[model samples]
Target: MGGTVVRQEILGGVAVLTLSNPPVNALGHGLRAAIDSALEAALANDSVRAVVLAAEGKVFVGGADISEFGTPPRAPLLPDVLDRLDGAGKPVVAAIYGAALGGGLELALACHARVVGPKAKLGLPEVKLGLIPGAGGTQRLPRLVGPESAFAMMLSGEPVDAKKAVAMGLADALETGDLVEAARTHALKLAEGGAPVRVRDRGERLDPATRAGFETKATEAVKKAPGQPNVAALADVVRAGFDLPFEEAVKTERTRFLALVDDPRSKALRYAFFAERETARVPGLSKETPRREIASAAVIGAGTMGGGIALCFANAGIPVTVIETEQEALDRGLARMRATYASSVKRGSLSEAAMEERLGRITGAVGLDNAAQADIVVEAAFEEMGIKETIFSALSRIAKPGAILATNTSYLDIDRIADATDRPGDVLGLHFFSPANVMRLVEVVRAARTAPDALATGNDLARRLGKLPVTVGVCFGFVGNRMLARRSAAGERLLLAGALPHEVDAAVTEFGFRMGPFAMSDLAGLDIGWRTRKATGGKAPVADALCEAGRLGQKTGKGFYLYPEGARTGSRDPEVEALIERTSAEHGITRRSFSPDEIVARLMLPMVNEGARILEEGIAARPGDIDTIWLNGYNWPAWRGGPMHWADSLGLAAVAADLDRFAEESGDETLRPAPLLARLAQEGKRFSDWGGR
Candidate 1:
């Protein structure tokens, strides 16, 4: 198994070609060559009547070699190897364990039959990376499992467990015992029937019933992704499998796959896929860095965010104590959490017993000292500085010496909060986004005096709790929200200059954001920002007046738009339009029509400018970190990449020019292109060109 990707063993007249690559046995060029060599040896041997394809690692074959992407195709491609298996003189069965995904599943599908281990997962999840299956997945999958099930699997891009694989006929059998032995027996049985039949030649599942509603399903698939064309491309390829000859359909799929390889959306998704891994690489920290043990945890406060934080620990199977100042508030928070869990159970997302088990991990108590028992305590109190300072001061006095102290602050200064505690090394920011249990992005803010071990613990625990940890330097709003503030400011400018909330939201949503800044603000409540603005001596004329009129948001059934009869979707209200025009007049601003493209540019480009500032200030390590944060925390479209990547794709010079023009037009110096952005534009460089400081 040393440096060998495939090991061939002739046992009981069946050649077992075992993939020996550790970790995920990705089908690199060498591995594909080794597989071909093994297959040749098996077919050449007179004693070998059948073949069992297996692997030594957890996964049989993970997928393609991502490192080989954007490069020339090597010799003996996966499709070639799969084609050899399809027309092999001897029967071949794939023994899949752990996972057989992407090209790996395509390889398995090419075999005469498949034996899946109990722990096996099978899928063709290429659509997730904004590409369809290139190696005959769209063709063979439908032939084996029928078009409807195959389309559902490919479009959803979710893996099916072993049980479901057998049920769907994707897997020939579920092997509870040794997978390779089962595969050997299955291959021998298939060989007894004569030469193996290729999956592409099978028409058993191509009945008219499978084709019913296929047109509607294909349309639905295209509708799933509005702005993105990859899904539509995938749907077209899958439809070609149903309508055209197998050979012709495969050619169609290949053409589509090759085209998608150069698609901006696919490239962005691929970049994001690598970027998430890059975020784990800390600059000053090494793999040997000590991480403080995080066993039991505590969350200070039982509000919406605080309860969500507690749920995160509970879901991770870590017992967490939720501390509240009063029993009533604690009870309310716990009840709300239970209701949320109950809804998940009702939707069949979680079992009743599992909900109870998760709930049992969360304990509610009414005191600051209750946090002292936990190894790490997160203060998810109000976003106000005084409240955070008071909690930290109390935490410093009550918490154990080695325990980590974290603040779940979105925008406040973490260093100032850490200054309240004597052990600033143990104090860091764990900025969990709203609905913390659900959001994956957790900003691990390193304070001025944060110890390496303490920072390491935050990153470690975040991963353990199934979160994307983007380590950021202490700054106002850190990376995501700091950039969000710039966008919010720009959005406000758009509203004051004649663009309505609905117009701005429409522009953003069309640009691939799930919701626009105005709609998101309304949903989050106009009062939240109004209170913050009032508290900070800041003014937002239109929003402040809306809040003053008690038009909070969807809860109040009115805000920037009308949500009549408690509707979630809002309709534009003439009163709000009048309010915006009146506000523009009051502010001595001229009203002008804004095209959707201009509205999108006005809002998004400023965030790109702020991202440049963030990178220059070392607030974020790299462009990817900002993208990962925004992608997870802010509903930034995965296809478009992040704000910085979007800017780089737009070209730095174009962005810099646009920002300069916007600044000049608006007479807003703050809207001017950042120094780093201006310099990068002048130097003909992209943000991705930076070495992340």
Candidate 2:
């Protein structure tokens, strides 16, 4: 009775069982056991006509305690506890708020009724963690809401609001105003004279015609989902409702759930799930480090990155001042922003009023003086040291005291930029991915002189903007694109050495990268590399010739491969092949055949090697940080567990040996295995094993 779940007496014939776990109130062993005991007591009491289940804090229950995912689950698994709850003759109502997800949603489904407030969100999000609903959710949800809606919820992992839940019949009734009071009132009504409500008995919605439609829709949905097995399994579980009895359906659900838990994809997804939470934690940093409150922010340029940065702030309801040097350039940037918002509106994501609200939050101006009032100033100007230094010097003099100065530099000297400011401690790098408003990653680069408060403030700001923040140290490239330099270079050599663009692209795409490297390159345009080459002082003759032939990328109708005019498909282009042959001959580099295995090996080994160097050099705090960067930013396949995880699977020692062989054959110093890689290989350890211990 004294354990976490407290059974407290309320009004006449109503008892309250409160789940009081901290953080997300995840139903762990203790909470699950407490729930079982409390339900037994509630059912025993003749006076306790009804019961209301609620959490003591913000959420009803977020999900399974992810900490307990890989380990043996604690007592009375959520499904079993929920089964006992479903069998309770006395009515039980779930008072829903915050995120009711995965097992949490299953528990709510087991209740006789659910009372969710307007602010509450409900979801079965196990799909994201590579799992399907195990605990009667797949069975009961389809019975209540039908298989079509259930399939969408399970496959997409999107949260539904109270209004939607009620509209779809997922909730018996939506709660109004105070959630707890409404839940109590609902329970009191059931206690007084209402008929018994059981989720399994909701057969009117699962009629023959409706069930047929659900099956048809579910068949179409699973075909579209990336992987087949889990979604198919979910559809099968839902199908059991018509073929088997309710109890039998639940047993089938549990058996399938356990099977999914054993799956490799599920393990990888679950590992990534915990890794994301772990990314927020850094060992040496004290929690006491002050985080500056960022009320308003500013972007110092009006280019693509700058405009996206401004939109990110606007999305967070933070007023942003965007500064540009010229009116035409500013108008162009604003036009890009307008087009972006228009696309969102067309997709039904942004209401016209909401778009106006976000647009109204941004103020475009021609002077840096307006930045003086901002709490945080992000410089996303052209990647040039002289220009960045000059702007920072001007900003250091004008910006409000205690304001955090951030650079949106993809790969530049954060320390040098910090040196440009008088308050070096206030300067840090916030490397937001391209199209900043859309990308989920923000590499927060820490300079040596950067203050703890500055780092904490940037990290907090990234979180507030709905982005993952991975702390990185100053280097040529921080964590992601820096290591990406090696991968990109590898991709270039692979293409030059007789492997066609499609061959290389196919290899990575088959390996689960959303796009092949060359395909991505074409989308990014061949001109960006031309600019980079000019900036670094060299001519990449092959790409230069490709650009000269009006082959920019998909936008220009061709780049590496020809695209049917205005279409996004690939075709072999003889002109590009001729250019490659000429370039190869000019360099006296003989073209040779390469296998898909070789293509993947060459492209990924550099990333693994550089990751090891990053680990040893402390540019990245941990190997997982590097993996997080790739997973969130670069579209590294989640199931493979990012690049570092993939490296672990391949064996670091094996990768090191491959690198050594590559270096010997290629005669390139960069191809030589990094010492850290060699050491780990020798020790038979993974980069993950060689973590920041």
Highest TM-score against the true fold, candidate: 1
Q: Write the per-residue lDDT of candidate 1 for residues 1-693, one digit (tens) a residue.
A: 323788778889999988987689888888888888889888989999999989987888888887887899988988888888887899999999889999999999999999999999998888778788999999899898888888889988899999999998899899898778889999989989998898999977776677776667888867867756678887788788767888898889888888889999888887877788899998789989998888999999899999999999999999999999999999999999999899999999999999999999999999998988789999998879999999999999999989999998887889999999999999999999888989888999999999999999999999999998999999878998788877877888889998988889998888998888877887999888887777668777788899999999998999988998989989999999998898899889999999999998898999998888898888888899999998889989989988889999999999989988998998889878889999889999999988755
Per-residue lDDT of model 2, residues 34-86, tens digit only: 88988888889888888998887778888877677669776688888887887
Candidate 2 deviant stretches above 4 angstroms = 1-11, 20-25, 44-48, 65-75, 97-99, 117-120, 158-168, 173-185, 191-195, 208-232, 239-245, 283-287, 537-541, 548-550, 585-590
For residue 618, give model 1's deviation from the true position in Å. 1.1
* Angstrom error at residue 519, model 1: 1.6
TM-score of 2: 0.91
lDDT of each candidate versus the true structure: 0.89, 0.83
**C-alpha lDDT of candidate 2 relative to the true structure:** 0.83
